[model samples]
Target chain A: MSRPAPRVVEFFSGPDDLSDQQREILRKMGERFPELTVDELPLDSDKARERGIPLAPGLVIDGVILGVGSVVSAGRIRRYLQPQQE
Target chain B: MTEAPKRIYLDHAATTPALPEVVDAMLPFLREEFANPSSIHAAGRAARQAVNLARSQVAGALGCPPEQIVFTSGGTESNVLALLGAAFAREESGGKGHIVTSAIEHPAVLGACRFLESRGHRVTHVRPNAQVCIEADAIIEAFAADTFLVSLMLVNNEVGTIQPVAEVARAARERGILTHCDGVQAVGKMPVNVESLGVDLLSFTGHKFGGPKGTGALFVREGTELRPIAAGGKQERGLRGGTENVAGIAGFGKACELAARDLEGNIDKVTRLRHRLIKLLDTASPGRLNGDPEQTVPHVANVCLVYVDALLLMLNLSQRGICISVGSACASGKLEPSYVLRAAGMSDFASFTSVRFSIGPSNTEDEVDEVVEQAAEMSALLRKVRTPEEIGQCDENCPCLWEERVA
Candidate 1:
């Protein structure tokens, strides 16, 4: 059986201005969850507005807000998505 | 599956990406204008003219006469030449051989002073007050009968604290001590008038202001005599020796010109963004700013988180796509906490938690907002793993002894 694809929504107002390490981690995250669907949210996107996104370049996973800031690795996103599991 | 986009760069103080305009201006000199400025040939004259034009441009940006400028390899060389040359010259003239500098100076100035100490010169380092501002009167009080030079930076790199160069210069002048202002971090970020600063020598770097690296200039007031540290050629009016870096100098000139024209607008925009970042960080993260907020240059902000480790924070932030600095970029590779923080009376823990976010002209409000959001997330994540108790127990004597064991 195959794992269900993770629905990933990334809100970035700017392009790749992040560090090299950060870009690498994001790439690794994509590799880890091959079926993950990434969506770019505009600064004024309705989803971002309804979810009360405080800033741009924020992340949301499975309808839960991942908080504002730069996301470095897939693990960091996973941690936010599944905070209950250590 | 799609990949997440890369992180953003917010650490302009550490260094800057070379501006495309500067690169374009430098290309011709690098390829075609590669001739010795000293040679009397046509190519040499071209190089000479380029060097002279750059000197005038730098001088103009600083509001000084062109003849007062002397180009050097970079800020380090300019600083060393200023401190060592001035002190040694005074010594040779049978005047006071003592020098006074700030406790929070960059290593370039501090290290030179240390070297002078070994050579039998007296040196005094004046500490800053609670606000991280060096008191001119305190420096004045520290002066000795033999004090010949006083070196202070216009802006503190780590904390972004602006010193009173004019007041300090006036104080130093009253006592006949020649003053040298390290304007490397000040010149392009603010309006710098050497005549108003009243300093005998001022050092500035090109890379800090969107120019090519390895190109810097020192402003020497007329009639202030100093012997050359490097002796060989008659380059730089016999003060510095070596064939001129024509391309680098030309780029430096263009960078200065651009900086002068855009100084105010750039400051206003970056300052607003910096304030927004500070406010966001203050609200989201458990930290406080490290220096006097109003007394600093607009582009730099130093935030100190109470319980978080700065290196860990930097690592975490880097993981998130935000590029910033832990402290002075030049001093970051060293495992030690910042000497500047220690001098400012920050505790070892506070010093360890301090990170410098130096903005530049190219940064925008949106980017600053993103940085704030990401930084808050990272801070929250780090705080969870390291409890306050665990953080308190962290010290040089901790049994974990990871750093020592590795060493």
Candidate 2:
């Protein structure tokens, strides 16, 4: 059986404020992990508030708050998305 | 007590609070001494005396003759007057002259040059080298036989890099080119002698040095003919024809006097505080100091955090009651990267991540300590949310990855 896809969520204070470098990071992450699903979460949204994300640039992976206030690299996303060994 | 919610300001480069002495000196001008300096009455004489005294005070601070100073609305007007006035004079003398200026100059100077260009004048914008200083050679290389004026800044407003104005001035002088310096950031924050700089014209504003806004001065050396930009009453020796900003000029004079008197001590204190803040920031987070650390002014510190957007960081700091800046106040409200940093050879991303912290004489050690603690805590907290590898191989765009990039 194939493993389930990793979930990736990028948080931003606003939609228009996304930087080109940040968009590049997300695109590269998608290329690395084919099963990875990326989502942009705006800080002003109710969903972001409910998740208790910091009011800055943030990234969450599979329900875990991985980063805030910076754009994450593809290599780091791969490391975070790797399957745990039992 | 909850410590009064800590309202520390690190944006002295934007504008300083008027000093008590400045305010006291200006009060008489605003109240009983209020009169048009041009009027022939006793009140006018008193006002003229105040303006003359202020002129002398400013001249004493700048090490120029009082007669050479022309009071104007502010730095912007002073810069425009110097650039436009000289360019027009050159044009009248049978030359549609070229002007050479730096990319890192304030908008006022740049705008004046742009306006000149729109009027059939040519302009050469010299870019800074990797070291962030506009090398004297660059200015010399940009100068053509037709170049009539060279306008460079004393201290850069964004990165705080000090240019070799004296060397550039000397080079321009040898070539018979007029020289103008926007000394807004350098006048009170550092040692500024118009004579020693050997420039034909220098401009400085009041608010940057704890004086009122709307007051500024331009130093026009003797024998440097300039056409007046504004046609009005023969005020400011017919160079800048307008009713003087009496209170603002009085305050500006007092501010200059105080700044000249205590400049060395103030520089020392602000330097120590600036270094302390930088050190604390380095320990708190992984980042790089922008600009030539040694060559830049002691009061302004620019730092580029690896993956952090400077605007976001500034907002975070503001939330904590700390005042900081991503760039110059003039460039505020725009998402574009700093043109000054770009001109200084900084990458676009690096420029986007940079923040400037400017110190002032009024800033205390305790405030510095608070700023450090807050800045460090915020930086560390922001970094912790992401993995160390998340920043990944920072290119030239990443100041965090390069040590030698700081010119």
Q: Each prediction's interface RMSD?
A: 11.2, 7.7
lDDT of 2 at B38: 84
The lDDT for every candidate, in the order shown, is 0.78, 0.80
Per-residue CA lDDT of model 1 for B130-214, tens digit only, reads 5678988888898888888899999998889999889989988888889999999998999899988999999989999799999
Per DockQ, the best of the predicted structures is 2
Tell me the TM-score of model 1. Answer: 0.79
Give the runs in model 2 whose Cα sits over 4 Å from its true position: A1-86, B1-4, B328-334, B384-400, B403-407
Go through the candidates in order and give each one's DockQ.
0.03, 0.07
Any residue pairs clashing in model 2, and if so which?
A: A67-B385, B292-B407
Candidate 1's displacement at residue B39, Å, is 2.1
How much lDDT does candidate 2 score? 0.80
lDDT of 2 by residue, B67-117 (tens): 999999889999999999998898888678789999889999999999999
Question: Looking at candidate 2, what TM-score does chain B attain?
Answer: 0.93
